[model samples]
Target: MSSADSTDAPIYAGLVEEQGDVLAEVRRVAEEVLRDADRAIDFGGVRSSAAYR
Candidate 1:
């Protein structure tokens, strides 16, 4: 198979979670939380974990 064909399959192919709805929830949290602070974390602005709370 070509490299392009492999891209058609899931990265977690054959895993049980890959076939369920759990990944959707994971992506949601990642986008909401991680993506939000990604910039500050990169610039060293977030100094403490408590800042998140």
Candidate 2:
């Protein structure tokens, strides 16, 4: 049988579910860093003039 059809599919699915928490944490960290960077660029006038167009 294919890997997807094997009995281990349930175990693999559980493993994937367990990763959701890590994924959420990673997303939160990335968003916080990006928000800080955006604020700096917005207030520091570091963006390119062409971006205003």
Candidate 3:
């Protein structure tokens, strides 16, 4: 195989190994956003009142 083809496997393997970290970071950010949204709803009282309209 050529050098380019040989390097492909290791590159792909490294990406697979790093997938968990990537997913964890994504989940962490998503949870933080959701938590902030919940806090906004609670403190702003937008759910009980239609003040947005």
Candidate 4:
């Protein structure tokens, strides 16, 4: 089973949470990713030069 599958599973996130410093750093990184995703430009439908569609 995966870490998130059950509480008995060995989870890296659990280890991080047990350590305050690592968990805080992880939270900071996650927040930055969320912020970047919010501000990100959507070029999804745009065709690239090499892509013929």
How many Å off is the CA of 49 in candidate 3? 7.0
The residue ranges of model 3 lying beyond 4 angstroms of the native Cα positions read 1-13, 16-20, 43-53
Higher lDDT: candidate 1 or 4? 4
lDDT order of candidates, best first? Answer: 3, 2, 4, 1
Give the deviation of candidate 2 from the true structure as CA RMSD: 5.6
What digit string (tens of lDDT, one per residue) describes model 4 on residues 1-53? 77557775447556756865675788999999988997796566465733865
Best of the candidates, lDDT = 3
Residue range 1-53, candidate 3, lDDT tens digits: 99998989787779869775676788999999999998776755656577766
**10 residues in a row with least lDDT, candidate 1:** 9-18
TM-score of each: 0.31, 0.43, 0.44, 0.39
lDDT at residue 11 of model 3 (Cα atoms)? 78
lDDT of each: 0.69, 0.77, 0.80, 0.71
Most TM-score-accurate candidate: 3
Q: Which stretches in model 2 have alpha-carbon errors above 4 Å?
A: 1-20, 43-53
lDDT tens digits by residue: candidate 1, 1-53: 89977986665565545566667779898898977787556745455655787
